[model samples]
Target: MALPSAPPRRRLRVAVVGAGVNGIAAAKAFRGAGHQVVCYEARAQLGGVWAPASHYPGLRLQAPRELYVFPDTGPLPPPEYDEEYPTAAKVYAYLKSYADKYGVTPCIQYNTRLVRAEPLYDRSDGGAATAASTAAAPGVAATVTVSALPTHAADGGKGLDGAAKGTAAAPAAGAAPAADAGVAAAVSSTGPAAAPVGWRLTLRTVPPELQQAEAGQCGGGGGGGGGGAAAAPAGPTLDKGGEGQDAGPREWAEEVDVLIIASGSFDDPKPPAYKGVQDFLAAGGEVLHTAHLRTALRRALAAAQTQKGQQQPRAGASGGAGDNGPCAIAAGASAPGPAVVTARFPAEPERGTEEGTEGGMEAGTDAGTEGGMEGAERDACRRFAQLLAGGRRVVVVGNGKSGDDVAAMLAASGAAASVTHLCRRNKWAVPRAFAGLVSLKWTLGTRAGVSLMRPLHPRPWPLGPLWEAARWPLLRLMEAGMRLQQGLAAAGAVPPHPLDVGLDASLHVEPPGYFAAVHGGRLQRRLGAVGALEAGAVVLGDGSRLEADLLILATGFRRSMPFLPPDLYGKIVRPDGTLDMYHAIYPHEIGGRSLFVLGWNPGLYGCLIADIAARWVLEMAEGRIRVSREQMRAYNERLYAWADAHFSPVAAADIRSGITVAYTWAHVDDMLHDMGASFARLTPWERLRLYCAPVAADLYTKVKATIPSERP
Candidate 1:
């Protein structure tokens, strides 16, 4: 590999992937660091997740625009919050504006998606050592050794010394076993022990030849200044499913100075990681993979590949862990910010009074059906002044963070929102109902009891099903949770600030996948009340049954950060085939620089972590901090160790069977530690991974020698 131009003696070349919010925000930081940064995105649009026309109907911003807006931007003025929440268009507009302000638009290549992101390590600096957690960091010649956990009991919750229900006990050995442990332990001891282990992630991998997302239309590899072959043509998108889709082979570009992965949890396509990913990993890629990976991801890619059909692809949104947070932990209530009012018309005090259905539900009553449409009975006009002077549930129906807050408040206040209760958890809305319980993610999964819903089926699946999308994100959250615990266990360091949290789910939608019209992957299925009903807690397509006071759909959006797949570090994929990316950033094994997620500052409030994320990326790009391999690992270990000390209490609880659960508080809790000890702190999480990588080189051999197999 020759110099793309002799690596300009005093300059560093950074390959900024994606121009979405996360990617763009990162670009700002990179620019600040004074690096020659070139950003690429697949779509012709600059806003990764903010592309408007592609957003679904009635879509509103997940978090308060104020909290969610990029770092240096201001949300809509006061009057904006007085009425309704910001819609996807509103947010997207804001995103575009943000780009304009930060000078991000110019540096971004709209149609160029980062088909691949890699770290172009300076070759002169010796290549990575095989399986060595102890190797000296890149650029730095000194060897740094990270010791095991300290003896201090790490846990920041109600001191374990008190023995209260919310206390953080020592890390228990009963944590999850390897991913291939055969059957998954019940979601909790209570979830249907007999409920087939974890759901199989059966990806109906549409054979390669016909995939979307892969169509290189964005002028990909047009040439150096142009984009060489990266953008040859476009492909079929999921907007046209199961058809003549022509996508590219899983693309690769692992060797780069900086890598950014922009695909989010449920949307963008992820053709199975073939040779490229494996080779990159084998050679040490600084990839940062996310749990948002979902079936639609592939579908989106497939959609992109549907070139013969010449169909367009999806924008950024997906379906999973929206505003309500993934599990009970994230669902716990935070202080109420301005409640974005949806319907603003006055409640007509009648059962059915048709208001305005022009563009959106007029702020008025729509003939009260059950319980006077919850909040519509009170204060609809004051919420959003821009809306009409009436009230409607539609404003609150779609799961906006504001709506969830309002609904949760109503539920906690001992009132009914007219939503059906998930029979097993004995809670309303499957997402947030049982949040208060320590680990009762869902009562069924926590208690050793049988579930009302029977098994969907069972089989060997490398990837979980797309139907179980809500629960998939938890898999990675759990893995990170486990490694945090394990790292602390070995370090023996006492956890300093443990968090006690709860989660809730308000994301409700009809299932039994079928669509009346499919243009751009938007399934006009008989959704909402008309399409389906929960047969036994699980939402099913019935069309005739619509029983509930409210329905809040928590639709997650698309995302992609830096260095995914091959260009990755940490224990993202343990030998057990489990993910261990601690804090959603660095890997548990090798602590390389990383980019985690960001959204509403609700569950976790550490602007510092966000700041740090922005800062770290910038520092790495500008050479302010040359992250050596060991330094990277050590940093990860230190953070995980601290994360365990601070947030284990919330995750330790058990979740329910067949229900998606997440420790929102715990996830955010890590943010707290990150806020304080970011970058500068050489905590255990970082040290261990950095040193462990080398010392444990041939890590498997070391383990095998210590514990010989009986078969031998």
Candidate 2:
């Protein structure tokens, strides 16, 4: 079962965008294959979505610890992380350790972004090469634009982009000199005469002061101050500069022989547009996507501190009797009314007394604030917690895993007066530990579990008909079991679709205490789209209104490749917003072998899938796995057709989603077969184990070990 040896290839100057799971894998793979590699990460740190800036308060891994590991890196250290599902911080640390172990950490250039990547070509033949010219002669085949991000840690620590505390920031390595800050091109060592076939990349350098200000505005919850009243901006708002800002970002350029995009799909946050959102913000109500939970929490604390500082009388406020105050509502509450305000603030004491004063000092004195900033911050945190558990009315949008986790977290913590969950429909959710005994990794994550489901194409002979006949009953039985286990029927949250249909659409793991919260009435579930927002209430699609102080949108992210040229982007992405990639890797229209995309496909285990994709890219680069344009087109057509038939309409509508969820093993097997790995040709015993054994990352160790190393 040995694979045919690939012909030795020339060393390539490879540039990888992103330093996340996929990016690290790509860098390690390319470097191992004797290619020059440098990875660009826009954030000050790696870990991708697990980075500190992206963590929500109660975030934990969706997959079990064993299934989330990188095969080459082995399992997460058990002694350090005892939880079956590790917290976000633990996962981030594990990723960092993995990157360091593989030598990928030092190769990463933090705080550097890939702005644009355009194909380059030679026009010496009196014919210019347009993006449409697939077979154009290659001589300097592409041009990429990159920018140096600000020198600031997103989580409010010391800047990791090469700046010391209270000191001026230094320019990133390879940045242009101060005088030539504007678009300077550094030709390859081969010179203009040679013009080797590669990408010419432009780099932008942001000045330290402007970068600091931008970081202050958008990062670390705006230093936990008055600016926290609003949700954190999705990204750095440097483009929309204020008075006294720098003229613009400085620019430079370089060249590379290859470009790999591993930015992944979670980059763009998709907060839906609601009517009167402006009014909501103006009224001091916060609207945040789940990605900005840290920011939202900080803002809540800051607003609470401000209100405590003011110590205004409740009677002067706009709302009716039992109202804490306008400022209290702004902090996180609605007035007592028929709108179902279930919590209230503790009664305030007379203002002049020390007991009523903040920090136990007399009312008019500055002595209460004398304990310094740290002490004040602690007070704010305590007050914010009280407000969260005792007074706030929160409305959560979407019912995906994130939505469920958030609602459950708030309810379990008693963080809201009324926790209302809004969604179009309920999704089927299974518990992490099936039947309260077997971990899902051993059930749904195993090949045996996948075998129970119908395949993308019809199987041969009697087995096909038998499977088809049994599938419906099996789905119904599974649905009934899950319904009883989750108490979905009792909570009136049972999904309308069967188990198979539900999996095809989206499968969620029930968050801890979610069903309990629902039954106990701490969390209320409402099925409808939000129609509008007015003052302190949310209007539902049926014209019913619910009092709300905070809104959290777990609506997920939008897939985009803004860094690619428009023509190339259009070719790779369909008009309907679905990706048009071949096996979710190569673009059909692109003729050259210089570009590759990783981490686009969603599956059961991200780290394992991404590592395999990286190895597949390495194989293609080394000429070990080759596909003709016709072959790719044919395969993609079949793939899309299968998706249309097997997936739910909602899931099939966007192929970039978790389309391979339950069938991830089949997808992995296909890729391994393409790579001609010996593991793909398993013995009878190994094959049996493959189907019956619990799935783990270590299963692919042999495949990884067999990949071609650097040629002498």
Candidate 3:
């Protein structure tokens, strides 16, 4: 008898929001699996964060580029671009190319915004089902609504309001308003009889043709569509006219089997609410969040470049006595001595801002008369060259990657008058490489390294003492190596080395210049908090003052899904401020499989993890990987319990950070086991040579091939 053929697999009509790395990858995954994928991006272009609008000029990858690309995708950078760590522009280009290679760009609708995705009840109209019988039955489907708006109105980076800004626009004749497009896909019994009820989507799109049509309707009043001749002449426009509501964009809706929230963090800019911040900005003291660096730094650098070009001597000025009498200023030399620092107190308490340290040396100290510039100092001076770029007095707040990166960039440029970093605590900074020789990937990114160094829970077994004893020799050796190679202690008085604190206080560092800069005094690392800002000055916690013209807040972002309804949001995001994801991807019990979130975790390899998540989601949709509600809840409880017991005090304050660090290995390892994939391909002898190697992205290729081409 002939072998039985597998049943036809179900294909979903998937809606993916955002054209970012995660979004693009998601679209590709769904489309490649024979599903219809529609990607909506609010911006006019792809490459969400990597796009020119979101990043600064000097931005580059913090980690190695080796694992940045998808494993199934071929060697990237195209050989034409040979840099290992490419600039922001190059990275953006790479993303664009990836979309093209995967054929995902075509399905993406640029300048489209997601308005809202509301669940549509099948049994009842609008309210929740209170009956136990009704609750046990298949739940209602959801509908997503989006409206089309002008690019200018949508790109303001405001919250959902910006997205829904033009939703009230009158529908034009013969045009398909976003509201009319709320068509759901037909369910087929052969493929997905058990598929979860779908979603209703509201979306908005701005087409050039529609803009011209609207302009013609208005008769030269522009695309505003207000009181002029452009007003719709007929009955039943997209919006049901109402008082107190402005004319919004045209909207439409669609029903999708899968709704992928690929709208990663970074859309909303969180501004610092320090006292005097508004006063300083109003007084012409420029203040910007790092999110605006791409625009802000680009303009500043272009102006400086132009001025430098104009000041350069013409080709004729390089010769003899006839060419020039005396050189006006030494080439490649800055003004003699350190920049001046002055203190100023506001005539009146400007919002009662606190005082801070004046950044220059003490009154009696002399320049170039301190300790010899060696080790940390040597590193600091090297970093100072980048910090002073553009001759701007900069004050960087927060000690995250963005803060450290910008500080180093300014110090190394040697164009800034002063660069001082205000930090809350002295967190451990792990160098990109251990001992300036071994890549951190080979040390911290490997299974052995993490397993050997992970903190043990005393509650479990007397394992805490055992872990401490086992790691003592390795910890001492590693500490000694770091001190000998980098001399981090001499750089500045950070807290006791993280190793001494059971690795609780450690912070990962990329590019490895921060420690050197801090210790060498090239970058002033102050042990205080920023109280407030005044004209030309910032007040520190210790009542000291620092003069800064440009204040850059490098505070990180918050994870939010404004599009999600309160009921759904409550289920996915917990009261503890942590996402209640089963594997940091799916909800424990979302009634049905209507929603899945990607790119929400803090992992060493974000791109890789997202790819893995895409695979897992697909498998779940195919009914191959089944996760019970009880099992997922138990897993999450254990994960959080461990975090509460072992993480540092600082980490405990934020549930996300604590769980992220503690479960990094378990997260990836468990996912691999679920997919039946190995982390590496090494000979028996080769595996013994190195302590351990980091998991390569390509290791999933074999497992991916095992996924049946037909269906589960």
Q: Which ten residues in a row have the lowest lDDT in candidate 1?
A: 338-347
For residues 434-503, what per-residue lDDT tens digits would candidate 3 score against the true structure? 7778876676666566665554323255766776678778867877777666665675544553553434
lDDT by residue (1-712, candidate 2, tens digit) is 1122343456666778777778888988888777767776655556665554433333456556666667776434333345666655566677777777777887765444555465543333332222222222233234322222212222111122322222334334653211111001211112221122234444333333333333322212110000111112222222332322246444333345567888765554456667876667566565655544433343443444457666432111222244322222222322221100110111111111000000000001111121111343334323433444346788989887667766766666564678899978877777767667877777776777766675765689898898778776866776777787888888778877666554642466666667877888878988889998888888998999988877877776555665555556676777776666666776645434557777666676777787888888877656566455567667667766776777667656644432466457777877776776657545676666667765656658766566444322
Candidate closest to the true structure, highest TM-score = 2
lDDT of each: 0.27, 0.54, 0.48
- The regions of model 2 sitting more than 4 angstroms off are 1-8, 75-81, 122-197, 205-212, 215-250, 298-390, 468-472, 656-658, 680-685, 704-712
**Tens digits of per-residue lDDT for model 1, 1-712:** 1001111223333445445555666667666556545555444445433343222122343222233333233223322333233444455566567666766666654333332222211111222211111222342222221111101112111111222112223323432211111111211122112111111000111222322333221111100111112122222112222222243222211122334443322232121221222222232211111111111222233344354466433212222224211111111122111110011011111211111111111111211112222344223212211111112111122232322322232232222323221111111112111222322222222211111111122213543343245343553344345335323233231123221222222222111010111111221112232222222221333424433322323222222222233323332444432234433443324222223232221122122223335554443322223233344445445533433443333231111100112333233323333333222334565445323321111221122122211110
TM-score of 3: 0.68
The better candidate by lDDT, 1 or 2, is 2
Clashes of 1: 178
**Ranked by lDDT, top first:** 2, 3, 1
Error of 3 at 2 (Å): 34
Least well predicted 10-residue stretch by lDDT in candidate 3: 354-363
C-alpha lDDT of candidate 2 relative to the true structure: 0.54
Order the numbered candidates by TM-score, best leading.
Answer: 2, 3, 1
Clashes of each: 178, 5, 58
